[model samples]
Target: MGQPLAPPPVAGDLSDRLVATDVWTDGMLAEHGIPVVDVPLVTFGGGIGSFVTADYLRICGVPTSAIRVLTPLETPWQSYEYLTTVSQIPRTERLRSDSASTPDNIWGFPSYALREGLQGDLKQLWNVLVEPIWANYYTPRAGAAFTAMEKEMHRIRYPEMVVRGQVRMVRRRAGGGYFTILTPPQGAAPTRRIAYRSQWVHVAVGYPGLKFLDDLQEYRKQTNDYGSVVNAYEPHEHVYEKLRAKPGVVLVRGGGIVASRVLQRLIDDRDRFRLDTQIVHLFRTYTATPHGTGILKRRKGADGWAYQGFNYPKSVWGGQLKQQVRKTEGAERARLYKEMGGTNTPVRRDWQEQLSRGRAQGWYRVMIGQIDRMTKTGELVEVAVASDQGPQLGSFDAVVDCTGLEADIREHRVLADLLDHSGAGRNPVGRLDVERTFEVRGTRNGNGRIYASGSATLGGYFPGVDTFLGLQIAAQEIADDLHAQGFGSKLGPGRSTSQWWKWFRNQQI
Candidate 1:
């Protein structure tokens, strides 16, 4: 999140010959003194997406020695937790995800709600049963998801497959398979660079980095005041700490889930401390009414918020929208993404009540406008707005930017290198293009494949490629593809039942 995680050093790590070649040869890597390790399947990114894929393969009888996870993270959920915590959805707070979107359980049986009920939280189970009717959709807390993942991670012996390093690039092999170059934590290996030779390469690097609005970027660049203007995705607990010490006006931008969480945190503190902290919410495009492409696809909107229980429509998972996107191409695919994609937040009763109270008390204010610019005003931040009403301006003690995931795939060095040196292409929505089976299209080399998942493959045939359940779906597809390629056993009904039992019993695979 800070400084874009400095790209892997290149000066002494790569050789001229290796750098110049598009397809890498084993001999070439050896000649350059780059240690080559052979693994049948290699997946980088080491996040939840990568973990899901590896977990599926392991359950299908793939041995740990045959798979490798190259990443800089200490754990699969490290980045996810950091982002959620900073965005104000700490361990105790519920996530904006469905109860069944369990990354740990591939079958999604005994869902989060079921588990919660087993643990004495029958209210959550009831919430899911009557979701969007008598109650809001049930969501798992951040801690529950993480704890479950930790158990699965060990059950699958995921740690054994992990190779802690920063992936630099993936190139097609001269004969077959691919060569994945990794920058080992300085001195972790004899060579600066380690080349992983694998028949299949899976990429799930998630988002390249956090996105800051142009006005916020310029404000910080000009004033060098990061403390006052912070991205909700970054560590900014100090902002709340300072506000607790004194009553102040805080400006919040964006209309997504994070904005909701941040607002709740601010109001929660104000109530707990009996402080008079005022909140100014700015919505670029206020949704005052229901909006959608058609009557059947309409989303609920009101009070300057577009309400969605989850990130995408439920149909996108396997319903009409999924079928539509899979069959569509080019402009049609792009249009579908545009029609469905937008910033929205789930409707929570507690937060809604808090917001309503604040509104009535005249402590919460909503404005509709795009920021013209921002400037320093002593310890406060002055934001100029341009909206339908007219130009306006205000000053606040702090500005919390909640907009996120706007960075392009090319912003990531490895992804850029994949496009430039490898044969990877972009989808209609400008992310890494992939086949229905999640293989990176056009990058296939004899008998080998380069598969990708997660946000990087967002615009592919799958519309929900960025969610927890989405990752599991991609893993299923990719695992099936590998099975067809004679890598792992097929997950037939018998095998699936056995694996689910093993999972339920917490038995090691």
Candidate 2:
């Protein structure tokens, strides 16, 4: 019989062009004319989490050439700044982040409070000193945080290691290590995709993406109107802009820091322009008083919003709660996370006063409910909410959803790929599971170790895994783990002190 004819080459056949399986070898890829760049480590999601990790590694003497950062952002804080500004925290406004959680300085020395004090802001200094007692905990300005991160980024020469692109997925290589496939922007690179082969991989993709409720998404889809119902994370400056231009009523959803900021902005506009603006704040779980499972662990709440100095109990950063969480596993760890997790905002006196005045003046109202449905009524939106009192209907100019839950990690292509193809499992809390070292469990491919941090790895040993301080802590743990694997020098006190001195001196590595 005649030899069977070979099948024709298919268009966009990634089997030869991409590393889709653990069986893909460097020789196989090279034979197909695909380029492979080898590096000791590669970090995806070059946000503050990646910056902090790179910062620690650089301090430990890791060269720029040995590491690669795959990110689509031009700067580390671009995504953060976008969220903060849209949620009413302009550059000059204070962030909800604590003063001590300085992402730029790993040692947390010369905290934001101290920096403000040095600049003649004695009031902020006092506030920090008496925080959670006589006064609310003080936080740093958004601009200060961004500027500090920028300085550290340059100092570490992080930009030199950044490869701008969207990370498609990570696949295990046959010989060893892992191949991280990145889809570079069109016209930016010669190839449609680029692969980075590395022994160590760190994933810090931040929040998967801001989640808009199903109802809001549906309303937008059916009506094709993007103006009326908006998420706090997106660019909704027009919502406030139009409100400032004329009188209007806005329904603010969720009871987190973003909600507080949104309310403050509305009240500020009302007070400044003397415009008749009404705000209706909605909460899913209304906290009424000091509530908790234990006396010493009580959280303060009132007027529908729970108040806390920070996101998690400070004890989670250290002390008994930290130990309690670290030792727990599976369901127990998830339960502990639930006990401490809830939407809470710092008790800022100014916003509180604004809210109080608003309530007394009948311009602001609070309702405990979930949005049942929403329909566009001309330029306004008619909302039906299932409240504790019962079903209620309201019409508002705009609805701002401030619920900042990271959409399921699977929403991101890379994270979804990790779960489906890399044998990575989710913790009981439904976030990426990791070991005490922040090493992603079950993704060990030969000598390569996959580590994760930031919001995606929240269910690991740390409760504050998404915060700035949490990122720093995660970085330290990952750095230590890498050091143990003989990748970089261990950051003992002596080395840390010397490196800190260089930082203080404004010396570059």
User: TM-score, each model?
Assistant: 0.97, 0.95
lDDT against the true structure, per candidate, is: 0.90, 0.87
Top candidate when judged by lDDT against the true structure: 1
In order, what is each prediction's RMSD in angstroms?
4.3, 2.7
Q: Per-residue alpha-carbon lDDT of model 2 for 206-325, expressed as tens digits? A: 999777778888998999989888888888989988898888999999999989888888888898889899899899999888888998778888888788878888888877888889
lDDT per residue as tens, model 1, 1-509: 11212232453367654675688767667556678889999999999999999999999999999999999999999999988888888899889888888999999899999999999988988888899899988989999999999999999999999999999999999899999999999888877888899999999999977667788889989999999999888899999998998889999999999999999999999989999999999998899999998988799999999999888888898789889899988998999889988999989899899999989999999999898999998988888999668999899999998877569899999999999998999999999999999999999999999999999998989999888999999999999999999999999999999999999999998
